[model samples]
Target: MRINVLQHTPNEGPGAIQSWSHDRHHEMYIYHPYQFGNLPTADETDMLIILGGPMSPNDDLPWIKQERVLIQQLLDHHKPIFGACFGGQQIAKTLGYQIGKAPHKEVGWAPVYRQTDAIPGIPEQVIALHWHEEMFAIPDQAQLLFSSDLVKNQGFLLGDNVIGLQFHFEPLADNVREMAVNDNTYPLDHNDLHQTPAEIIAHGVPAENKQVMYTLLDYIANH
Candidate 1:
């Protein structure tokens, strides 16, 4: 199947997901709104994967508003979607869910406690990359799937096809390192969810997370 990745920034590319698509021989197209002018129609894409960025979903940027509309359109059609961090918040906001600052930002590697009964395909707990200051209320039509100590609303499922994750399941060791080097706006020292670069590197390799991501992709592919 063809997958279209909506990349918000140059640094935050579609890490492991891109590799998975390539290995599966799936057609993967990237649409970087920061570089591209507009989003494509639903007919032009089979699935949508929205990546993370430094920007918030509530940002007043014109492209953000346009992307929200496109997200809503994909939802209206029941098209499969997988979003991370800010992308997740955008999906929540477009679905009439509330988006706001969390008590604190979750940075580095953290374990997300899965409400397994809520989502059949996911595990009980998964070590995911966290790098967001904002959180969202689970949409009324969606089912809560996961939660973390720092962020309660870690993930939600809209219908059987669409999924939003506050944590980054697609993080590679390089991605975590890039985040550590570039993200200075959010102070991570006092945050309970913060982790050291060594800790993140120890577990953030593609081999460690590939099965988990593949399971998610399989769920999306089947649903």
Candidate 2:
């Protein structure tokens, strides 16, 4: 399968997702619309993985709108799509759902409770990385997948081919470090939910986190 990634920033590239694709021997490509204004059409892409960024899906940038159009095209084609953070918000916005401010700017390792087994293989509860101030609202037709204390809508599964997550399950230790170094004000403000760079990196991407990510990828691939 030709799995294309939509990367909004260099630091937020596909980490575990890339590994999963490689292990599966599926072709994967990353596109940077923020830097190169390039994106793959639905016809050329068998599956699409959208990564997160600091930007909002509600931004007024031309590429933001263009990305939404491409998302719609992929939806029309019934292509599998997995979106993380801002990428998740893009999918929500494209589906006419509201993207609003989260109660808190969750930015560390936190436990997310699974709401349903609709997408099987994920545990009932698992600790995942969080780093977003805005959250996506679950569409009426989509199944609520997960939830956290800071964000009620942690993830959602739209139909059988689309999944959106509010947390970071794809970043590895190096990717986490890159996120901290690249963003000057990474933590934004230290709080109960937000942890220091050291604290966040110390945990790294746990084995279970990587397993759950691979589980999701396998589910998407098989479907």
Candidate 3:
């Protein structure tokens, strides 16, 4: 299967998603719309994975608008999509939902509770890394899948093929460190929900975290 990842930045790559693709023996392609502005067609992409970024979906940038158009096309064709952070917000925006600032900026590792058993392999509560100040609203027809203390709409499942997660389950230790170093705008000023840079990189990616990401990919691939 061709798993195409729409990467928004250089630092935030596919991370554990690349490992999962390699383990599954699927071809993985990463496109940098922020750089070359290249994107794959829905017909050629078997599965689309949207990575996290510092940019907002509300940005009036050309590539951002173009990415949303591609997402809409994929949705129209019933193609599978898995998005994290800003990518999740893109999916919500394409579906006509509003995107805005979260109640509080959730950074570093945090606990997100499973809201439903529709998608198996997700625990009742799992600790996942988050680094977003913006949030996606749950669409009317989408199922609320996860929620955190700071953000109520942490995740949502739209149809059987599309899944959006507001947290990072795919970032490894190095991925987290790079993101923390490159982005210094995390709202960690006396915020209880926000973790410091030192604390964020201290704990490496858990085995269970990678497994959960793999489970999500497998579910999206097979379903």
Candidate 4:
């Protein structure tokens, strides 16, 4: 199957998802809209994975609007989609949810409390890489899957095909470092959800989130 990933920046890539695809021998492609904005037709790819980034959904960029229209097209065609962090917020925005400034910025390895599951592989609680300041509300008819102290809508499942996760369960240690490097404006002054750089750098483990990511990918691919 062809898995196309939409990347907003050079730093953040498909991390563990890319590893999963390689393990399964699935063909993968990446589209960097921040550099050159263009999208593939529905027939080109079997599934889409929207990756994390420093950008917010509220930004009024031409590329964002174009991506929104493309998202609608994918939804209309009943294509499967997996969105992470900023990508997740974009999906909620496409579904008519109000996405804007979050109350707090969650960076580093944070604990996410799972409320429910559409896929059985996800545990009751998982620590994922969190790096975003924008939050999203669950769209109508979507099942709420997870939540954290900083963000209420951590994850949501829509129409058996689309899934959005506000946290980064797929980022590897190298991916995390790259993400940290790109993001210069860390809100350290705010007491809300700000962790020091040393703490984030210390928690390094690529193997931690790989299996769960593989399980989720298997579920997404088969179902």
Candidate 5:
């Protein structure tokens, strides 16, 4: 499978998704819009994976708009899209959802209440890494797949081709460290729901938890 990853920062790489791609021996092409000005053309992309970033999708920048155009084209083609955090906001914007600033920043590991309508492999509740301050409204075409007590919209499924997650299931402990190094978000108790870096790492990345992430990616690979 040919996958195109839209990365906005040097710190945020594909992480576990890269591992999954390597494990499957799938072809991956990444485009960094933050560094170079060009976003990848979705022509040969079987699936598009939008990674997390610190930038807001609502930013009025040429590159951001350019990315949106690509997103629209991919949506029209019914190509699969898996987006996290900022990527999720971009997906929601392209889908006509209002992206708003979250009252509190959710930075740490948190549990999401899985909806009964969730796809296979997503348990009733799962603790996933989160780091974001923006929330997107659920598009009418999409169904809410997961919700947390703090954030109502955690994940949504819009057709089999598109899925958006507000948290980072792609990041593990090492990935978290990388992000921490890039951003001065340490001292950990950034907010009430925020956990310290040590706490998050202590929990570690569970194999089963990552398998659930792979399950979602598998859907895009096969379906």
Candidate 6:
């Protein structure tokens, strides 16, 4: 399978997703739109994976709009699409759903409760990394997949091909540490749900947790 990842920032590159691609021997391509602008051609992509970012979907950035156009095209073509965090919000907005602030910012490793039928190969509750301030309403056409104490719409699925996760399933321990250190300006001190860098890293990345990510990618590959 050929997987194309749309990365919004250098720090949030495809972490565990890249490991899955490598172990399966799938061809992987990355487009850091933050650096290169929107250059991926829809025709060249088979599976699309959009990673998280600090920016909101409604931000006036040029690439945000351009990526939305690409997302709509991918949805129309029925391509398998997986989006995380800001990417998930973009999917919701493109599907006619509203995106806005959650009651609180959910940062650090939080348990995401599965709400739909079991995801076949994945677990019910997983401690996934999160670093977002905004959340979105599940699109009317999507099946609610997962939820958390702080965020009700943690994930949703559209048919068998499109999946959107509000949490960070692709972050490795290193990625989490990098994000916490670099993005320290995130209202951590002001918010009750926020965690310190040492606290988050102390939990570390679980092996089974990473396997769940591979299972998701495997499902996407076969779909």
The candidate that wins on lDDT is 2
How high is each candidate's TM-score? 0.91, 0.96, 0.96, 0.93, 0.93, 0.95
| TM match of model 5 to true structure | 0.93
Residue 223, model 3, lDDT: 76
Query: How much does each candidate deviate from the true structure in C-alpha RMSD?
Result: 2.0, 1.2, 1.3, 1.6, 1.7, 1.4
Candidate 5, pairs of clashing residues: none
Off by over 4 Å in 6: none
Cα lDDT of model 5 by residue, 57-146, tens digit? 888889888888999999999888999988988999998889998766787777888874547767788888778878989999888988
- Angstrom error of the Cα, residue 137, model 6: value is 0.9
Q: Is 1 or 2 the stronger prediction by lDDT? A: 2
**lDDT of all predictions, in order shown?**
0.80, 0.89, 0.88, 0.81, 0.82, 0.84
Write out the backbone clash pairs for model 6. none
Q: Write the per-residue lDDT of candidate 4 for residues 122-158, one digit (tens) a residue.
A: 8787788887778899998898988988778888888
Residue-by-residue lDDT tens digits, candidate 3, 1-223: 9999999887788899999999999999999989898999888999999998889988889999988899999999888899999999999999999999888878778889999898887888889988887899999999999999888999999888999999899998888889877775564664557577778888667778999999888887887
Which stretches in model 5 have alpha-carbon errors above 4 Å? Answer: 186-190
| lDDT (Cα) of model 2 | 0.89
- Alpha-carbon deviation at 198 in model 2, angstroms: 1.6
**Distance from true location, Cα of 58 in model 2, Å:** 0.8
The clash numbers for all candidates, in the given order, read 0, 0, 0, 0, 0, 0
Which TM-score value belongs to model 2?
A: 0.96
Clashing pairs in 3: none
lDDT of 5: 0.82
Q: Cα deviation in Å at residue 10, candidate 2?
A: 1.4
Off by over 4 Å in 1: 118-121, 184-190, 196-199, 206-208
Q: Kindly give the stretch of ten consecutive residues in candidate 2 with the minimal lDDT sum.
A: 183-192
